[model samples]
Target chain A: MDHFILMDAGLGNFVVFVVGPIFVGFVIGALYLIIKSIVVIRRELKNEKASDNENNEQIK
Target chain B: MEILIYLIEGCIGAGMLFIAVKFTILIESPIIISGGVTENKKYIASINSITNVIFNVVLVFISFYKWPVSSILWYIIAEFLLIPFSEILAYRAISKASVKQIIKITYCANLLSFVAGSLFVFILIALLGLF
Candidate 1:
């Protein structure tokens, strides 16, 4: 059998390949989520400020 | 020696979980706040974010325990399942669902994924102990 398959056959190789990548992917995915959220939050805050300014101008 | 490995594993596991939860919250926050959804939906999203953080912490704890290869396979499976599951839950919660429905679905999905991930880690450790 190939090395990868052999590794899969045993638990140790499985941990290094399968578990390791999954954890790494999870971390990356999480980081992506955080960055995306921050951008969205900033946009929303800007919109809120603009709307507030519009209302004030209308009153004046 | 094992202790050192366990410690390192614990740190990495916890760090990953923290990052994941933080990212999820950041991704969903704007959607919940600006979607003009009901207050209930907003509240549910907030609760889901908090729960996700807590769940990741628990996963970190489990990962720290150390496990054999057979069990590690299960952990890998659990981790894979959580990725899409969490995304769907967040999407649904922040979207058009009624507050009640959002709460039920988010909670169920998050809890299920968390438990599965934790169990997989736990089982890996247990199986390793057998050898």
Candidate 2:
């Protein structure tokens, strides 16, 4: 029983040490791209609206 | 020693935050400037290019920070996974497809990114048993 517990603990430690960072990096990098894209899209929308308004004013 | 580690981590955290913000600005600026003139596809492509460059820089920074053959290898692999994951999430959230879609996809994307970033640090600590 004691040996089994020790083996489990060691495995857990390895996962934490080796796999955790890679997972965290993957998630964070995903989030960064998502946020950056959103910002760009919003800016684009605002520009589109502004241009539409300018075009309307010219017509009037 | 703890203080030293924290300080170094803090600096790295700050640097990462700054780079993220810089990329956001770079992606946004062009759309704002050429709003009406440029097609949506073109604008998005430009933003994608800028984001890619920023991502590359970030990967390079992470590599240097972890320098010393043994430790750095895992970190670089982690970075590789991160770059694409973030990009796909952001792109999906941004490109709302139809013109009439009323949902604030951009805002959603940003919020998701912020949460993910914070959670990532915690996950890293847990994984590395650094804390």
Candidate 3:
């Protein structure tokens, strides 16, 4: 079973093979989430403010 | 054959994260006025982290069908690193920075880290003569 996975894998191989991908995955994933969260927040705030103004005018 | 499999697994997992983030941003674009900007960013960041953990767990399951305990353990450890990264970016985004500037900075950061990780992996593979 070990031979099937890697002809000769050690701690180093496991580090690069298993941990490496997860590291890269998180890097991109976090960025995507960050930008996304920002965009969503800004857009939502803008819309909410706009609606609030409309409601105020309606109340008047 | 095994090397290619690992490479593909990494790519798929990364791609899945990208798409999941995009989908989340799109679906939650409208604000419900529950809190201030900073508060909202924190909520969104927390949500993203949750989804990311679940996503990574599923990816690990699919990638390693026979799930060696060591491999799964290492993967989980790596996934935890995302929490800090996400929080840092969230703080930056909610700071006084403009959207364009924040996006550019985060994009460069992500690209640089990805390239660095890939290069390190390749160097290790070359050194070990695994490929």
Candidate 4:
């Protein structure tokens, strides 16, 4: 199976396309995760500030 | 033979795309975006690589569908034509650069890479034929 696929240029390219980009896609995916986490953290902080403001208002 | 040639061209084309994008980012940084991709270059490069891979795969499927043997040259005309637009859109999504800036950078980059890659392939083919 490996012999047949490895010997052919066409099959070999598919391997390059797939295997080569795994690292690239993985890195990009990690960047996306970091961006997402930052956005989520910002939203959470904003919501906490909003809740804290409401509590202060209630106490006043 | 045709399929083999096509596959070889595809591999070379993809490699050229990366080199072109990287170089274009450096060259255009001063004139276009003024360090737009500087800090996020790693991210952007990875994204561009992924986008390029997706397009190449699509081209392969399209080219291989109708025939058992195919030429990458004719299909490449269509591929290069579409690549810049997709690349522009991809770059625009990740950066704060203006549309005009993105378009110019992507266009120059794709053109440079396509010309270089195709020339290399043709030369290689010619060299092979000589022996």
Candidate 5:
């Protein structure tokens, strides 16, 4: 029983050490990209609206 | 010794962040910007974001492949704090913020994240030793 417990602990640690960082990194990277996309879309919308307003003023 | 270790880790964290930011600015941002003015902004943004996410994931995997201490919780905390930096950079890129302003903001964010992340890592490593 003691040997089994030790083996399990070692395996768990190995998995965490090998896999955890990659998983975390991937999550952070995806998040950054998604946020960047939102910013770009919002800015584009603002610019479009500004252009539209300028066009209306010219017509008037 | 602890302080020295912390200081070195902090600098490493900061350098890593700066490099990531620079990579995003120079490579990923350009691809997103290549969409012409007449293109649907929403569509472009969606595609760009998806593509960039994929790119970043690959980069991250490579970065952490052989790195020490794969503590997910600590990494998550550090990254969550760093998320705002990327968001701010993205906003600035889209708004065409002055280059100097962008650089300043990036530097400040990098510094902040480095300190926070380094401290977190230090505590985490110590805690791991206890376990």
Candidate 6:
């Protein structure tokens, strides 16, 4: 268990009550960015594969 | 009226869980376990939200009727001990992250939620004061 009492109560409270939520929001935003990147990468792979098939058919 | 209040609190609890978990997973390795990370997050968050709401209500009732503990002691137990412990276990069961990673995520995420919840209640109290 965390001994929050022995620590600096004022500073801990300030961090948790003031800065904490903002940090959480930033992390959540980064998670969304990860999702966006994944979607983009998948789309790029699909497009590349489609183009590859087109070239192969044309060559035949 | 109490039912409406419970419904509102339940929504708030679920929303808080969703927001907290959405972020906490990024605190460590952004593990993409062959897709469906989002699905897992939703599943875990739903379980957590329900548990949290019920636990809080029980805590409140316990502090009043059953146990009758002091405010400070109750706060310490609920915030420092029980809630975080439960969250850690919940994350561990559902999350594929390492033990260290899950611990960090749960603690930090709970801190974030504590801050937000305090502000939320403060706002609600303030709004009530106006009326």
lDDT of each: 0.53, 0.52, 0.54, 0.55, 0.52, 0.53
Candidate 3 is graded, for docking, as: incorrect
lDDT of 6 by residue, B14-122 (tens): 4554554444334212332222222344434443444444445455445665454554466567666786776666555545567776666556656666676668668
Write the residue-wise lDDT of candidate 4 on B23-125 in tens digits.
5444433433343532344444444444444554455455656652454654465446666776666556455567887777666666665666568668889
How do the residues B11-124 of candidate 3 rate in per-residue lDDT, one tens digit apiece?
A: 776676665555443333232112122335445544454544454555555566655675555545543455335534664644445555544444443444334544765787
Enumerate residue pairs that collide in model 3.
Answer: none
Please list all clashing residue pairs in model 2, or write none if there are none. A29-B86, A30-B85, A30-B86, A34-B90
lDDT of 1 by residue, A1-60 (tens): 598777767888668755665565555545544555555545644655687689899999
In model 4, pairs of residues that clash are none
Off by over 4 Å in 6: A1-60, B1-39, B63-72
Taking all chains together, each candidate's TM-score versus the true structure is: 0.37, 0.35, 0.36, 0.45, 0.36, 0.44
lDDT of 5 by residue, B1-131 (tens): 75565455445544454454444344334333342212344534443354435444554565566553444543454344444355445445344446565555544544454455467658888999999
Each candidate's interface RMSD, rounded to one decimal?
8.6, 6.9, 5.8, 10.1, 6.9, 13.3
Model 4: lDDT of residue B127: 100
Local accuracy of candidate 1 as per-residue lDDT tens digits, B1-131: 75566456655755666655555555544544454333343343444444464345445446566644544654455444554355455455335556555455444544454565567657888999999
lDDT of 2 by residue, B1-131 (tens): 75565455545544554555555445444543343222366455445544544554455555656465633564344334543345445444444343222123333333444455548667877989964
Task: Give the distance in Å from residue A60's predicted Cα in candidate 6 to where it truly belongs.
Answer: 38
Error of 5 at A34 (Å): 3.3
List candidate 4 stretches off by more than 4 Å: A1-60, B1-39, B65-81
**Deviation from truth (RMSD, Å), model 4:** 11.3
Question: Which DockQ-derived CAPRI band holds candidate 2?
Answer: incorrect
> How good is the docking of model 5, by CAPRI class?
incorrect
Per prediction, fnat is: 0.04, 0.03, 0.24, 0.00, 0.18, 0.00
Q: Please, what are the lDDT tens digits per residue for candidate 3 over residues A7-60?
A: 556767878888787667666555655566557656755665687689899999
Model 1 share of native interface contacts: 0.04
Instruction: Show model 2 residue runs off by greater than 4 Å.
Output: B1-38, B42-131
